[model samples]
Target: MDQKIKSVFDLQQKYKFELRKTDSKTRIAKLKKLKQALESAEEEIYVALDKDLRKSKFETAVTELFFTYAEIDHAIKKLSGWMKPKSVGKTMSNLFAGNKIYYEPKGVCLIIAPWNYPLQLIMSPLISAIAAGNCAILKPSELSNSTASVIHKIISNTFEEREIACFEGDAETSTSLLKLPFDHIFFTGSTAIGKIVMEAAAKNLTSVTLELGGKSPAIIDDSCDLKKAAEKIAWGKLVNAGQTCIAPDYVLIDEKLEKEFVSHFTVAADKMFFNYGKINDEVFGKIISEKQFNRLDGLIKKAVIEGAILEFGGETNPESLTINPVVLTSVSAENSIMQEEIFGPVLPIIKYKNLQNAIDFVNSKDKPLALYIFSDSAKNQEKIINETSSGGTCVNDVLVHISNPNLPFGGVNSSGIGSSHGIFGFKNFSHERAVVFQSKFGMTKMIYPPYNLGLLKWLKKLM
Candidate 1:
């Protein structure tokens, strides 16, 4: 481990006990200062995002900045309530004891954020960690170096190193950070890396909250309004050039509606990301890097070779590192594109004869981070939701579910572990310590070691 990094970790370890004692007012004030810093660095953020991911100013504001602001605001607004001890129901066995759950900081924490939505991912969990009164060390993805630099600036300028610190580097930096016994580790990134993080955390018995990604699906049946659904799906998939964790990796549509869906999807993409039939770089973002670009490019090529038709958008601009929104039709479940999370502007349309088949198909693979069901029938929605398990779900829409801070956002199994956002996020960084206030007289006395035969009989009968 680097001496500097080790020193920072030691500083935070020594400071964690004090940080855990901070009140909601102190935390809120810190959040407010963070918000102010974010405002001050808004232009720098935009420029950094543009340089790193080619994100437009408006898109940056909405997807990245807006989410961060909302999270901070939500935490500030709900911190007191969330900090209050939650009373738990009492049972006859403990009739004289008042049970409650007290939220406490999980000491020092390490937050590892991914490249995609680099700003928001780091800030969101940091907001939760601060709200929960934990000393945090942020490790932003090195792939998104520009945005990471901006984040380091914001964090360094706003907080003390002992209370909150940001380290900027490649996997080496992350590996060194992970070696420390952080009380909790919050990570948002690919499943492969998520596993690595989990492994490291296990060495210290460190608790972890992994926001990993999988091949989240969009199931569109005939019942949905094709045009409306197409438009929403287009925006969701192509907004960040399909680099979103919850972006529909592939569309499972009613077989008969494939043609109509393709037409609508193309129109939707063009309208959303084109001007005068030319690509609109402003509304759309470029692929993160040359490596990611080549990977996506390979997926599209392999899928076509294996018989999936390129329905729309396979054009790539190497110089700009941009791949236009791709739509693949007649895609097989076994296609190479379907094998992994296509974190790019590539959408494969797979036809399904029956809704049950679609559900079964999804079940055959890893549970997704998100499942999108675009159907009007409540029965259909209920059926899919009931039969399938995902980290989260959206009905009749797409990624908007993540915008609501009131909802918990995460994945299941390979997709992710644990949840974040709003109160759920605050709890993720907190330890729910169970507390009980016992009275002088208590029912538990009867169950003490004396084990009187008559009292045992009475307790057994009561149970």
Candidate 2:
């Protein structure tokens, strides 16, 4: 216990570090090590997530395990190139000179992972931090005890604590951890708590990257492939029991196609629940916990009282944290469910008379991390993409946008401030140092100081 406490202190003291000398070979080797650890401990990881979130083995594999390993693979394959110096274009005034931007590790960083995507949230940022060559301290969500412990065990057992440390605790401990001045802080969770993290970070003026969730609206144009759209939305919303931030918060569709949309959606749900002939043992995953369960339960009751039509799977199973997916129709804007982030297996299908109204409704709320529009029409897709100011946009897909490493992940307004993933992720955790080399002979001096008043006046005007 004493050693652990001391280690934490050491981690906090050295909040900034130059991770393994920014060498291409070294960076590649570290990413490979992370991959090996993840692959070797696959079963262990799945079991832990299952124990904490009552997560299905399949959900565990899809949401957390695979994504993390893919990020690691991406980092290993691209770290060498990303670490290379980028040549910057010279300004008109400095035509003869050269300027380049160099990426440098921003000392020590603190990554606070939320309970929803415990492993993925924590590890995804780590891939970038490692590539950027920064020592990091990761704080896993205390709510997900099993996964947190597994992460703590693996990180502690496999790597040196100084280079990367995993601290496990409740809110108080997390608050204590935040007191340390880190060079950069990356957080993923609700906007309410995201504000708290940002405020705490302000004490040190540390740069922060927030990945908060908002009401991300998915628009289904009239020309869309309804069968494909319904199938994708159902799968995404129910995955991990709709705990995903990018899961279709709510879907917008043409009022004429409402019934058709509902039919396909129910069918997709049935197919997911009763996949093949066998019941998909882990089809609709469990709600994270009873507190979360109660929160969602309240919304369901309120919506029901407010005259929202409910379909299948709204019942709660405490033993398994299993709350059946609830498909709500005729849900109006005034309904209680519409007021909050329905972070459960509840899909509220809203109908709009015009596409502009759908766009207007989304704009009225806080800016979302992602905006997904399923449309076959090029014009409609362009309209949504061009009109909305979201962090990321997917033309015809749902959560699949997040899978693409080429795109940066983050929210715009209330959703979040900074982005992560790919090059965006590396730059988020590291600071790009602008470098300009000058010669000792000063050959570039157009007006050297001979105490000339005329030269001083010209330089002032130029500046």
Candidate 3:
């Protein structure tokens, strides 16, 4: 094993019992301290995020810092109830026995977070792991170096090395860390990398919670509020420059409303960016890297080559590493833009003759992390909700479902494999161990090996 990994493993092993024995008060205190640390380091976090992705303070607060604080508050408020053993109903066969399900910690855990929303992804899972009474190792994505550095500093200052250690490195470091036998692994990244993490975890039979991305779609019916839908979709897509996992990748709209929807969407984009005046302004974020910019550039070029109409904002400035929020119309399913997950500011609008065609279109692809429906009709919402399957869904809105602590945020199948957020996150990091206490005078002796007519009659009576 690598020396660094071995040392951290040894530290966790030495303190595993101490960590497990932490009372709810101690855990809550730790969460409070973390919240304070984040508060104090707010400016540093903003600077780091801006340096990494040109992310503005408003975006960082809403998507990263504020969300982290919310998770911590939720965990602190509910930790005691979550820690209490739940009583289970006793069966007739075990009338004198006490049955319960205990949420036991999974011991040492590893949290690998992605570059997008770097701080929130890493800290959210860590909050649950700590709340569940487990030591953790945090591995922030190297791509977001500035944010990763700030995170490492914050974690080191706030937590004891044995309690929660943060490691900063590249792909080679992740490869080395994965070889260690962690009790649980919580990863958030692309589907391709999620496969590698799962495979590595399989070698040790390590439990994992994968938060991955896919081509999530938004459906707009003629019965919906077009202006409100347009504004919300614009915000969801433009936030993080449309690098969000649950952002509307494409739009499926009624054919009759296509022209009106396009006009409303264009107006919404103008309202969002008109004041900023340029793509490099603070209101808009730059692509994370030159490579990502080129990839997005290629997709846009291919879409145009294949005869997709560019209705608005397909401009790319490589020097500034920014791509304006793009709206493409007349896009076919066979277009290169729709071939894979477009984790950029490109939105493809596809017109459908009927609502069933929209549902069928979504079903034909791999299940998405999120599905958005912009309709006010109760019947339409219920029909879509019943017929479609996704990790989560939002009605008349986009990207806001994840903000609710009551909802379990995760993907199904190709989108992802496990859930997170709130109590679901706490349970994700815990093992529901079934514990039973058998009374001294149990009923088992009555049915033991005395194969006679009298015993058979007794069994029949019990049945």
**Candidate 2 segments exceeding 4 Å error:** 1-20, 275-281, 440-444, 447-463
CA lDDT of 63 in candidate 2?
81
lDDT by residue (275-311, candidate 3, tens digit) is: 6555546678888988889999999989999989999
Report residue 144 deviation for candidate 1 (angstroms): 1.2
Ranking by TM-score: 1, 3, 2
In model 1, which range of ten residues has the least summed lDDT? 450-459
Q: lDDT for model 3, please.
A: 0.90
lDDT of each: 0.92, 0.82, 0.90
Q: After superposition, how far is residue 135 of candidate 3 from its true place, in Å?
A: 0.8
TM-score on alpha carbons, each prediction: 0.98, 0.93, 0.97
Q: What is the C-alpha RMSD of each candidate to the true structure, in Å?
A: 1.1, 2.7, 1.5
User: Could you give the candidate ranking by lDDT, starting with the highest?
Assistant: 1, 3, 2
Give the higher-TM-score candidate: 2 or 3: 3
